[model samples]
Target: MSTPTSSSSSSIWVLSNIKLQFFARIRRFLQSKATRKRCEPSDRFDTAKNKTEPDNKVENFETVQVTEKHKEKEEEEEEEESVIMMQRTVKMLHFGSWEEKEVAVKEIEKLAKEDVKVRKLITELGVVPVLVSMAVSPVNSRRQAGLTALIHLADGTYTNKALIVEAGILSKLPNTIDLVDESTTSKLAELLLSLSSLANTQFPLASLDFLPLLRNILETGSRSFDTKQCCLGALYNLSTVLENAGPLVSSGVVPFLLEVSSVKEVSEKALATLGNLSVTLMGKKAMENSSMVPERFIEILSWEDKPKCQELSVYILMILAHQSSLQRKKMAEAGIVHVLLEVVLLGSPLAQKRAMKLLQWFKDERQTRVGPHSGPQTPRFAMGSPVNQIEAKEGKKLMKSLVKQSLHRNMEIITQRANAAGESSKLKSLIISTSSKSLPY
Candidate 1:
């Protein structure tokens, strides 16, 4: 008997796309029939009728051949599907031209814009170090695209916050803040904005040593006005995260802002940011010590077009309102009332509300100075409305209550107003006391 050939053996058994088994098996069967004197398949099967008659519309021979071809085609299709599935299972890396990169960026943006996908992609891509490297690349376009992608990744998700912070993204902030060169605007500004959005995150902003770096940017005279504006925006956002960011802000930011305001060439954003940060830090104790409020802030009160600057003046007055009646008397003596009244009258609803609040805080500042009502050396009260007496009796307590509400309603607004108005380290007390619950007769 003849042996089965490898090719026929492969074709005979559908050995998972391995060909040749079927032909081998057929050859073995034929040899066995010949050796044993068995009838041939053609003779046993009536070969002429089987080969020539039609099974359906076609001849039997053609039908059988077509059926076998169809089975092979199906098997090939399944193999192709398996290969495609394997390709999808692997992590994909894309590289291409600027246009292609932009298309990829747009696709990522589309995914991220969906909100749900942003939260998802951050978790999946969190461990990929290329994302971080791209964010810090020397190439501005690549760097911006990376940062924009990262901001979406971290938006409002605490899980993502932990991941990116652990990935050393926070460590890159100092370098971002230090980029004062004009050519880096697209990259640095994008990075700075991303860092700013992290303000509400749990990522320990103070630990990054960002304050000193930001202070360097704000205080350095060699940088341009645009750089200063960017630094101030970052600083303003950062102040929300940092509890006692007053001294750094106070030591020189106020003076720098005043200088910027005086310059015809200074960017308006720089001055506006300066004003915003001044108001944010106003009520903190450290800021009070910085003594940032003396004269220049008083000067901005008169600039009619700069409503933001005027708002800053009002905020400073509100913080300094914490000083004793003698201090208010001193401020009034220093000509603060004129500019403050201007702020009180201008602006939209939020501005008007802020102005009224500051007005209330300023009017009630009498409690800061109290001698026994009958003492011979007692400071004479400033002549004003009955509100002054009510304020002296209940102002600090009421101011403290208002502070609690402000903290609850929006700590950011109060903080920003304080910083922009130039209140350095002074923060209004956040603690609430039950003592004010029942008015004492």
Candidate 2:
């Protein structure tokens, strides 16, 4: 019933509205799909970037760890190289030209001074035998270098000293001692002294004809002071063993020591060696027979600058005093009692004790001589008893003379000590009072 134009217009309006709504829906759907694609790719890219970041961090951590390990390995290699270098230096001591050998030995000496480990290494490398060979070489410079190296090597631990001894250095050293110059001889003697410090080394040394060599060196006036000191030191060390005592006495060491007993440089050591030698019975007898022994001991005992010598000389005299009655008589006749009494008053405590013991022994001996005897008895009322009186008178005279001489000697010493120490009045009064009241005679 409506008009046709109005209806048509209404139908067209409805169609246009439907078309616009449908197109808007289609455009919105397409735009959502495009946004979804873009967001998915962005999420994948962010995920890949996160994964790559950790991998890079792990790679950096591994690089740092690997670098530290590499550095540690380098340090180890360097330490090993140093040890190898030290070993090569030791080995270079042999199988070289004279100059090269000299250089090698000096280098070894340098290493030897490093520490005990290097010294033991040098010993184990069998360098000692080659050094011994080089020590006896014809070239003076090489010989000196070899001896110097041995000196340093032997200055190590006991194992090092034994290594040198086992190397047959004792046998080779005696012959070379005479052929070398004074400097080399001194070094050799020093080496020997070091070797002799260990126990049981002296026997082989003596058997290797070293005793005579040492005696010759000591007796030679032309030797260096260091050589003489070293020789005396060696002898002193060797004579400490009781078995070597007799051999030393018989090998003319006693005479040589006595001859050099006055040498200021070696006198103390010489007296010490003699004291060691006198520790045995055979040595005691030898010393008792030597007139020079008591005389030298007395001289040393009176020295003001050498208190050690005084103590040692007193010790030797005490030993000799205990040997036999005849020896005691000889010591007393040699005017030893006054010296012993003086030392009892003025010497060190040990010396004082020894001097007192000897004096007591002398007193006991005198008492025994004058005491009643259990043997066959003689009547005291005999007319010829004048003989005993005369003998007693002579003994008193001898005793008085000894005491006077001792007093005079002590006064001189006291005066010297007082003047040196600026204590003249106090010491002189003290000595005067003590000597007056303390004379046992």
lDDT of 1 by residue, 315-386 (tens): 555454544454555665666543443343334444445555544444445454333431112245678778
What TM-score quantifies how close candidate 2 is to the native fold?
A: 0.69
> Where's the lowest-lDDT run of ten residues in candidate 2?
370-379
lDDT of 2 by residue, 1-441 (tens): 568989978865764565455445545655575556446545655556567467776666557556655665576566556555654564455445677778888888888898887687667656787788887677789778988998888775888887777777677655434566777778777887788787455324545357777887887799888888888988888887787886788787887887788777788898899888887877777888887867778777666567787888888887876636776777777777767766665667777776766665664453234223221122253466887666656655654555556766677766676577676665555566444335433
lDDT leader: 2
Give the clash count for each candidate: 46, 0
- TM-score of candidate 1 on Cα atoms, chains taken together: 0.46
Q: List where candidate 1 sits over 4 angstroms from the true fold.
A: 1-119, 137-145, 155-162, 174-183, 201-206, 216-231, 241-292, 306-309, 324-330, 340-441
Local distance difference test scores for all models: 0.50, 0.70
How far residue 71's Cα lies from its native spot in candidate 1, in Å, is 27
Candidate 2: regions farther than 4 A off: 1-80, 94-98, 175-178, 200-208, 323-325, 361-441
